[model samples]
Target chain A: MNAVIYALFIVLPYVSLVVLIGGSTYRVLRWATTPKGGGGLYLGLYRLVNRAGQRSYLSAVGHILARMLAFHTIPKNSYGRDYGTWLSVFLFHWGVFLLIAFHLHLWMPWLRVGAEAMYVMGMATGTIALGAGLFLLARRVGLRRIYGLALNALDDYVAITWVVLIIALGLAMRALAPPGLFGEAVAWATGLSSLHPEPPPAFPLFYAHVLAVELFMIYLPFSKMAHPFTFPVNPVLYGKFEDVDEVRRRVEEELGW
Target chain B: MVSVRKVTYGRGGRDILEESPMYGEWRREFEGRGSVHVRIKEETDEGTLKAIGVTEMQRIDRGASPAERKRFFASRVAEMARENRAFRHHMDACVHCGLCIDKCPEYLGTRDPTNSPVGRADLVRRIYRRLNKASDGLLGRDVDDKDLARFLEEVDLDRIWTYYYQCTECRRCSVYCPMGIDQGEITRAVRQIFVEMGMIPEFNARTIRGVYETGNNMYIKKEAAQNVLDFVLDDMRQETGRDFKAAMDAERADALLLPSSTDFFSNIGTLKGEIAIMDELGLDWTLDSRALEVANFGLFEDEAHLKYIGDNYVNAALRRGVKMVVFGECGHGWRAFKNYVAPRLEAMGVQAISITQLTAWALRKGRLRVDKKVDAVVTYHDPCNLARAGDLIEEPRFVLRSVVKELRERVHNREKTLCCGAGGGLLTDELMPLRVWAGWPSVYDSLRTGAQYMVAPCSIDKAQFPAVIQYHKAPIKFKGVSDFVYAAMYGLDVDKIA
Candidate 1:
């Protein structure tokens, strides 16, 4: 059971990463290649990043990081009429980030000391996220206007069920599993050089959690969630003036003001 | 008391009048209600006087001859259907919801459907469609001399001309248009056709011709332009005593300040503010009096005129060897300078920047600082020529917010802003009332915000808004952003800033 869990962790994430990265890259490239005019202010990525002076570089990076962490594609002002949808979005994103951070402890040897604390925090956040996902799914199924802008019933069902499966399995593994099964599995996985092989009992919940999380990761970049990365490409930033007075003066002087 | 008069005609062969209404009433009052006056003028050359009176009465219709009428209608229709894609698109896009009707100053004040831009465009389109179809079916031609005459007679040609030309093409109607139809384009096309037909209002014609010949619409001579600047600067010195020089053609300056010629003559406050802002920012800016006309009416005329006015700016900038040029509060002037003039300059290998863009840059660079606590509720009116038509909306707002305390934004701002109804060269005396009416809705909208002041960075709007405010009884001061900036920075010491 320990060997199998370790193998699944390594295999699932790699497959998910490959699909998400590849699909998003293709979509973005296709959009870029399409011809459309009147787009306003076309500067390369380097120039765009360098804009607002060098001192703003760190702030710009912070802004981008905040967006990714918080799923900040939808503006606060726009969510005035639909706060619940936005709140659910916020919780789900926070849960995903926390869960990923907790999973990093499993992979990184240096973070092994706080593994138990990380696991508890991750499970608690995951439970709230699962609830939020289920709420959003209900909204999508019941409310026509809200659903019009969001995922359809099938998509909502898949997303909510996946999150629920992961949270349920995570909580079950910690609370309902046999007393020594989980500890034995962890010890066997961590102790690579120890010749004493301690194989723990197989739990169906662990496999279900792994599969659901893997499916979610692979679906992320291709889903509406991809809008998070496109925040920087907003036209307002590009069209805003760098120097108003100089341009005005030059025009006046040229026009024989 | 009501007075009534009765006339009785005999039942005989010719039925000679027993008493006419006027004669009978006078006779009854004078002769005890029983007798009538049988008076006649003494033999005093009746035939000669009668012939002279008839000729005098016929003179009124002298200009409305068959040839003149045909020419007028043919030219009007041709003008309405000029080869302008912008005009065509706007006409085609109108949804005709009539929301724009009440928004029109002329339509509201006079209650005349003919004055509405949408109505005017529809009238022209209907006639064009009808004439085209009829001619195609019967005569294998669109318009003929007789058809033109009849069309003119049917559609009050003179009134249509006056009503259509009265529009400033400020694009107030475009804001309410669901399809975003720029009625200004149609108005412009109409104006162009009128010009082609030699039917332009005398004042506009003179101004257009003046700009064509003298390079400035007002036709202020080069020497006069310098003198006006000198006079203003001398006044500034007297007022503040700090050698406020209106420097012209300063070599190798970082920025070239371009105020409209009117700023030097009449609108000195705008100039003073521009100078103050530059001084506060510690910018290396200089003024050029020679190319100082920011109100480019040439854009309203043909392309040749546009090029001619644009060249003046380009030539002046190149001659001065300045790095950048700044414009005063003139919307179409800036529109021409930024959109048309700058491209022309670039094509002619002249490098110059837009004024609004330069101001935004200065703010970003910390060259200019606004206290941001000079508390006054201010809202910006985006000059139509600059905002929707010219792609300059945000810069002015950004600049205004930087300088003012409480900057209240109009609900429909930026690209969706209403026009001030003084664009497209309709700022003459004849069109003043219509101009005020055109600007009434926007003025009212600004008032609704409960703003203490409304700021527009367009010279035409600045000049016209005062009248609009007065007419609407709106208790708000209208000023340019530069005026506020100048007052804040320079205070009473205009000379030090200049």
Candidate 2:
């Protein structure tokens, strides 16, 4: 029983890491080899203005990060504009993002904060993630009709359910004891990289959260969850609303204006 | 069973426009049409296909049953992914975020979920997921022969024909998508796959063949086109007493004007306006039979045809020894030229400019003068290609504003412009109802503005708006920007002359 528990907690993480890295690398390589217009598919972006090269890298990075962080595109869509899916999506995405950052503090000691500050931050982020995640799940299932949409595939249902489960389990751990599993979690999480893998605490909520997260990491490369990894980093412009004159001026300079 | 003209989209004769519960009505008719939309394979010219050097795939064996035909396509789907990288990336990237659903004009017009961008993408994405074994069967299963057979059942001729053609390939949804997954690209790739398997719509297939044989989609013979131009110049001389003239490839010309064949046959006013503007400015320009068609219909099908059609224009421009190739009124044709073909020209130390740009630039420089603003209140419609895709948002409006007394802006203008339902080769007699409904938003917006004239610098728009206005009983008249310029230049009241 102990060996089995050890396998789930320790052996499974490296296996998950290998699957995640291997799967993503395979997808990228598969994409790299394919021909787009008898040329490589990865040959940068579809340049609209002939001479308008890439904007400064810093600005593009900031612009891409802000657009992704704010979930600004949702509001532009009709359902986002009319039915308020934008706000719901914004809350859900950020809440989960902050919650993950908080979890990362255990793995990276440099990100650690004061115990009292960490307690307050942990609880706040957990409640937000759980609340928003549940709403997202409901929108996928029960509230779909209200949004004038139907769930697309079995993948849609499973994706939302998995996310909500992780958030709910994490929230439960935070609420039930608040400070019970920190040392054990830190020891186990930090030790995963070391030769001697440490054991996790015998707490159901903590075990469940770790289990859900590890399984999700393994599943990420195969599913649509792989989108965010490439999307934000990809060179293709997404909702960079420059004034028409500004775009025109930038292009004209290159066109011998 | 309601007549398409009388299908008012749920509004009283002069009431404010709102969406009527007409989507359900449309859904029945569209689905009922199904694979009947697939024209006979005779439309696909094998010789033209070879001339274009199209990447061939396994054609459907006619003796096999329909089920066997789909099975043949099942194997070829993977080959398509291998041949086109953009196809694979777009297929991989769609997250099925239902935000893009209503962004489609077809879905908004028809209210069919499957006709929506995400919905259309999801259909092919399901089979793609299983085919590539990208997703394991937590919900998505691994593909064995039995799984492949079961999965291929989901990808049918009717589903591919109806849903993919329903899109106008506007890129409206792509602009709004956070990840920029263009459903238009996916639709083209799917169309290419089916086209290889000896299936394509009559309208798209016939038009491509027309371009190859006659140097224009309309198949207007050179002699017939010359006679029409002469007759129009004669009419201009008689009416306004202007010495407007067009010649076939003048020696030492600085630029070549490739007029849309539609302008030669249908929108003669546009040709007259272009000739008048260039003549009044004393810009040296000539027309040639080799590059007569300004619009490239090849863009509608796939890249093979796009390059083939584009080569015809490039060769003509090179032969003329002109420094510039000026495109007259066309939508996606301008996009193909500006984005794809312009770079090639620029590399050769030649430039490609739209007539709108040329006129707008000349006007700004005070080199070309409009003698008078035509006595008309005009609303400008931005064709989809010229706006977001082509980066020509302001140039046409600048030209229109110079020629018309007042330029009224539509609610959705510039980057947010609505598509005239007939772009991306969805302009066919059989798809006329779909076109009318898809064009409702543009017509409704124009009507609300109470503009006397609706001006778009697109041949497709010039052709489409007439049908949209007549069906919706809209009072507004449709004309190209050039018509207004010509009217303004001659001090002719467009209402009387046009």
Candidate 3:
């Protein structure tokens, strides 16, 4: 049991991390080297920069950041006034964001919080994330009969359900378990991140949560979950004005026109 | 309260209410391909493909063996995916969020998910993905003969031809897409792939051939074109009491104008308005009989054809020794000129400007004055090409405000404007059902505005919206921005314009 936990937690994570980094890098390289002919990504960037009037790479980047971070595209206009889905999406995204940020404490031992505070913060964020995940999953499953049959892939539902379980387990651990259970896991994480492998507590529910996350990380690069890494490839979000010129040159040169 | 559920065909004729498949399954076999039975190698009647310049619907297969056909299409898809970043990103970025499902006009009208932008894009995207996998051999996976056969079978040429044509390529879906995935780009890529397979649509091919043969889609001879211009100019003189000169192929002019061939016959008022503005501003502009078209149907087909057709206009302007080329009231023509041809034109030391920009400039500079504005309230329809593609949203509105008593904006105006459904060469009589359904959103929105006239800046809108009004029994009249501008300049009363 210890060896399995050790391998899954300490050893397998490194392998998953390698696959994530390497696989994503390969996809990115493939995108970069691919001889794109019409203005796809570049056209979007060109429009953005051209609209913003700066017409520079920095302006494109700044606009992309504002759009992505500030949720600039999510208002009634972009999402077609579907405020229900929009609210759920907003909650799910920001919930995941806060949850990811909170998990950074596992790697930094110095950033320890008091038991009561950790419990409170964990319950609050975990509940929000769990609730949002449940809402999204329910919406997907409920709409499957009406509109989902044409759009809902199995992976879509699985991704949502997987995250929901992870968050739910986390909330359970926060509310029911003794206060210091994560302290050992945090120490183990800190040690493992620093190249010294440490076995965490032998709690079955805790290990179940950890294993689910490991499976997710391992599956990330191969599935749509890798959208974050490839987000910059979307022309509308990441294109610049200069890209139009680049696209024209590429088409002319590559096609030998 | 339009019945949005009227559109019914789902995957493989399965009632969407009964049983539907996931998006992945939907792509492999969704046959919501309207009623058009396009068979490979079976020649369609020339009269049925009733479009300008087309003589016959070419046989799709052209005697290629199935293996050769499969290889040809597969290789093109592979090549496009390997080369085009926009194609790659759009194909790969779709997470099947289905956010674009409810927003599509075709989907809303037809209730077929396949008509939705994401659904339409998925048709090509799946093929692109399969091709990518075969090429990359990701995870040491090799594509076997059976896999290839399955792919070829699923991506049927007939289905591909039907679905690709059904889209308007409006990019409305992109505006609402969470990842900013422009399905239109993917549709363009897919259509390009089809064109490579030698399966040219009769309307697109014939129109393109006409442009190459006679320098315009209408195939009007230079003598006939000049005659039409002279007749319109004579009428303008009698109506306005001003000698507005319409020059043909002047050796050296301040600017060259390109108006849609349709403007010469049907929508002549807009052309007269253009002449009035040019005359008032004292700008020496010449309209060449050889390049007297602002509509480029090649934009709806393939890039090569677009360049081929676009070159004619550029050559016409250069031959005239004009310093600037101003596009008439045509949307897609402006798109082709600005996005595709403008760079090359700019490099050649000639400027390409839209009529809206030129008129707005004249108005701002106080070069052209309108003593009396038209009293009727008018609504402006932002042609998707001008608003989304060319960024001429405010310029047309500014000109409209200058000429009209009141400008009422539609519920979905500028950037988010609905297409008049005649775009992307889906203007044929055979596709009237699709057109009327897809046109519902815009027609509905226009009706909601309660304006007397729905004034669009594109010539296609001028031709398409009147039918929409007649079909719905709506009281609104369809006209152009230039038509009102002409009225503001010449008509004794606003009622005369109305």
Model 3: lDDT equals 0.69
* TM-score (chain B) of candidate 3: 0.88
For model 3 the interface RMSD, in Å, equals: 8.1
Root-mean-square deviation (CA) per prediction: 21.4, 4.9, 7.1
Query: Candidate 3, clashing residue pairs?
Result: A35-B83, A36-B83, A36-B84, A41-A235, A45-A239, A45-A240, A46-A240, A46-A241, B7-B110
Ranking by DockQ: 2, 3, 1
Instruction: List per-prediction Cα lDDT, in the order shown.
Output: 0.55, 0.70, 0.69
Of the two candidates 2 and 3, the one with more favorable lDDT, higher being better, is 2
Candidate 2 docking class: acceptable
C-alpha TM-score for every candidate: 0.54, 0.87, 0.88
lDDT of 3 by residue, B132-220 (tens): 56234577665666787777776666666776787787777777776777877777777766665556666666666667767787788
Better of 1 and 3 by lDDT: 3
Relative to the unseen true structure, what is the C-alpha lDDT of residue B482 in candidate 1, on a scale of 0 to 100? 72
Q: What is the lDDT of residue A29 in candidate 3?
A: 78
Best by DockQ: 2
DockQ of each: 0.01, 0.32, 0.26
Winner of 1 and 2 under DockQ: 2
Which tens-of-lDDT digit does each residue in B1-498 have in candidate 1? 111111111122211112112323323333332111211111223233232232232222324675575455555555333333344344333323344544444443333455566666765655554554422123376666676566666665554565566566666565444333556656656554544443445444455455555555567776887777677666656655556534666776766677776676556777766666666555567776556677666566444445556777877777777655666678877656765566555565455554555566567666666543345789888877676445567777777776667788775566556567666766766555455555765776677688998988787887788887876567888877776666554344322333
Q: Candidate 2 clashing pairs? A: B137-B140
Pairwise DockQ winner, candidates 1 and 3: 3
lDDT of 1 at A228: 46
